[model samples]
Target: MFKIFKLKENGSDVKTEIIAGLSTFMTMAYILAVNPLILSACGMDFTKVFAATAIASAISCFVMGFYANLPFALSASMGVNAMFAYTICNSMGYSWQWALTATLMEGIIFILLTVTNLREAIVNSIPPNLKKAIGAGVGLFVAYIGLKNGNVIVADDSTITAINSHWFTGTPLLTILGVVITAILMVRNVRGAILIGILIITLLGIPMGETKYAGGSFLPASPYFCEFSFSEIFTNHKTLSDFIIITVTLLYVDMFNTVGTLIACAGKSNMIQKDGSIPRTREALMADAVGTTVGAVFGTSTITTFVESSTGVAEGGRTGLTTIVVGILFLLSLFIEPIFGSIPSAATAAALILVGGMMIEPMKDIDYSDYTELIPAFLTILMMICTSSISDGILFGILSYVLLKAFTGRIKQLQLMTWVVAGLFVIRIIIGILS
Candidate 1:
């Protein structure tokens, strides 16, 4: 069984592989806590979210390790959670059940696209430059989310406002402190710098009473398990629309995020084919879709692959054992909220800031020779920061690319998918403006 799962490669020791896998999972331990909190805030049952996240993480890790044969781990994606909170919940006022339905539908769509090879083609059709821009834009979007959630930035009447506090005498001081500390550790090439930063902030918050520990005993109870419900999604129209938008958003974000992560990890692991394609891309996508669908039905938001898991891969995880270890740890999570809760947002923020920095490297790959690439890239990055949605950044980027190409007599350069995306972007923007 171990051999079938590639738990032990020809020369690699099983113990060593397990160690590597555990280390990788450690980098993402924050998800166990944060994902549930995000979903709970969005009106999901806390117990259900907890169970769903664990199941999703386990399934995602299993698929990534054994089926997809990558070192990546899957969970409720931070980007997707933000979309569920800000767009689906806040903007659209969709219920949590409706949003979960959307996520399941998105997973189904993703699976179909992957099987038909349409997903690959859409990925290919994106100009390399635009892809790089998408990377940078996603980085900014992730950072923006970290800041917003951490209360570093707040909305104001005329414009967005910065707070003044002890860190700044209420001036986003804690946030600044968190960012600077994380950035310094990252610059020093510290492993787990982000986690460390979060720890520091969390500990500090404890003293200031900014955070409280929920003093509950940890144990895997019946509370954390749920079954999939296809009927809840298929029978409702509002649920259907919610599922469509949220699922499309999840699929799109994961598509690009996974592509970027794969390219980078494959380069480091020598997993890329001679032709420069990452082999098993389809399997990986399928695994991601299945994990997410499973996650939603189990009562979580949306499960997608995590780029941060690459930190563990970079540390020497060479086989599926690493991800399997992650899965085991998640199962153990059923009994350990206190340990996970000890982790602070500051530490997670630090890690996010560091990961955000690492993600920006893809921008260097963009072909700046074409103005078409340059313009769309700029717009994508800017929109991500200002509008605070990774999907918006991507949609705007695609729309900008198509509009520019069409107006400049380069209509042939636009893909059919681009037109379809452009139409959706127009509708979304129109609704956003009207709202």
Candidate 2:
């Protein structure tokens, strides 16, 4: 039975593969909780978001395993969710349903791009330095979110503040402790360290009254389920501009995120060809686009491939089995929210911090040899930290790259598509600023 799904590669053990898949699934289990939380913040129905995530994960995982043949997983996207909540919902005042509709449109656009092989042209046209900058910038932005959400950093009137308190006094302190413990375990090369950290923190929360078992109930009662109004999406023109901006931003972010993740995971899984390219990338992209569209229709934000799945690939997963296991786990979550919800935000915060720390390793890929590269990379990292948006960081990085290259007479070396994308970024920024 295992042979049906297992890779035929020499020296690959089935037992190790299973373990790797489970590890990856555990590392990403936070998504089961985080996805709904983010959508809820956007005033989406929690139940619908949950359903969308499960469906997206199932489709994305199956496609990744069978079609892409790579050890990666896809699900409702994190960065895109943040953009939906912070930019579209908060800044633009779009109803959650309308935001979802925009995401669906973006997903369709992504599918078209993938089908035509434009994804390759677009990715290759990006300067290698800029790509590296985007990766590191996204990592930093996600880490900032982890910190902020964990309440490690709180915003004052004009500055960020850290609450220095004892571990037992509050959840933030507990999160800090959990982060330190998880980091220690990860550095020690312990298997399932992330899951272990979550367990430990959940246990701590239980004792501290931060978590409670929903006695005799299989699923914790969620008050935020399936409450979105699709009619509101079409009727509300007040948020059209916001919807357009978010849709475009998420589309670009999902595109690059999937590209970067596929490349990274392909390298790690040894799925790359001798030329350092992953075959069937278009199929994988199509799967992602489909997943996003499905998610939007089901009432959520964009769905895309997760780079965090690499945490499991690094452990030894090499086939679709890993994603299959993840999908099964996600399906099981519907009946077990109490177990997950019992896990305090502090615990997940720790996991995010640990994951963030691991993600920062990609920074080494940035070419520091050229001043032009270094400046853009630095700007990308800084913008991500300051603006707290991965897309914003990318925009700044690309803009910086184009301006620097143009001034140095190297503009002709860039592709036409590069200039076009850079131009779009400029226009978007101008419109956003003007609005």
Candidate 3:
């Protein structure tokens, strides 16, 4: 297996890779509970969704490690899952089955785009500043996820984002301690610092009642496969536009979120080529695409590359071996669900917020002298943080780039597909308004 993975060639070894994998898993293990919490709102079974989350995550990680030779781990994304349950199902009045159907379609589209290299073309088409901005913006987007998940930041009735300090007594207080401990560990260059922090915070939380001991079953029940709702989806002619919007929205977010994360992770690994493509690019994307297709079939939302894999990279995860370890850990979580399920959100939030802070590392490469470049890039970062939407940030950033270039008589600088993408985003927005 060492020879097969070329661990040394990738500048990694068994011990380091194992540590990296464990680090990555600890950081992202929150999805086990979080995915179920959000998806069960759609009336799905909590235990089943929880089981599906781990299974889907494990499958994707194995595919990525064996096939793509990258260190990134895959899981049900928090933002997209919220959109799946809330926007598509509850608000649009579609069944969860219909939502799953849309996710399947999105996965197929992903495979098509990746195989055709249109995804690569989109990545290369973005200006360097915006690309760096995407990385930085993704960092903020994820940190926003951590804050919201940990209840560090609460929705403000009168303002945009207000600190919920009044309710920061128990879990929230522990969350603060976790972040501080994790940050201190990272600063001190402690090995497995993030994972160690999670373990420590979890132990502390058990006494405070922030982390609960939930009962569990030996195994998830049989016939666990969740199928698409194609028949119902196609029959609803009135919701054709809704279906289109939902599919496209999922596709766009998944695509760019994957792209932004790839940039951040690859940038950290020093894996991006001079021309701005990742090595084993097709395989990595294909693995991600397959994970989504398979995950939707198992009754969850979109599964994409987790940016938290960067935490492992920061811990010296330079090869697919790290990913394989993460994959195995995820599978193990299926049977010993009680142990992992006991960890508090505050623990995972610590790792997430710390990893998110590390995501800004790529921002150093952005060219600050050029206002033309700086303006859109800043907007991308701002919109991403403010809207808490990765795709929305990229969307407005592209629009700004196209409009600015056109107004400045620099249309020649823009790529043809850049213009095309900008126009499509505009059209999508317009249709969204009319519908």
Predicted model with the maximum TM-score:
3
RMSD of each: 4.9, 4.1, 2.1
Q: Give the runs in model 3 whose Cα sits over 4 Å from its true position.
A: 166-168
lDDT per residue (tens digit) for residues 373-428 in model 1: 88898887788777655566677788889988999999997778768767756866
Clashes of each: 21, 2, 0
- lDDT assessment of candidate 1: 0.67
lDDT of 2 by residue, 178-293 (tens): 88887888789887677677778878777777657643346533322333445665565645555566667677778766766665566545565554446677777888888877
lDDT of 1 at 274: 47
Q: lDDT tens string, model 3, 303-331?
A: 99998898798788988889999999988
| Prediction 3 global C-alpha lDDT | 0.84
**Candidate rank order under lDDT:** 3, 2, 1
Question: For this target, which candidate reaches the highest lDDT against the unseen true structure?
Answer: 3
Give residue 150's lDDT in candidate 3 (0 to 100): 80
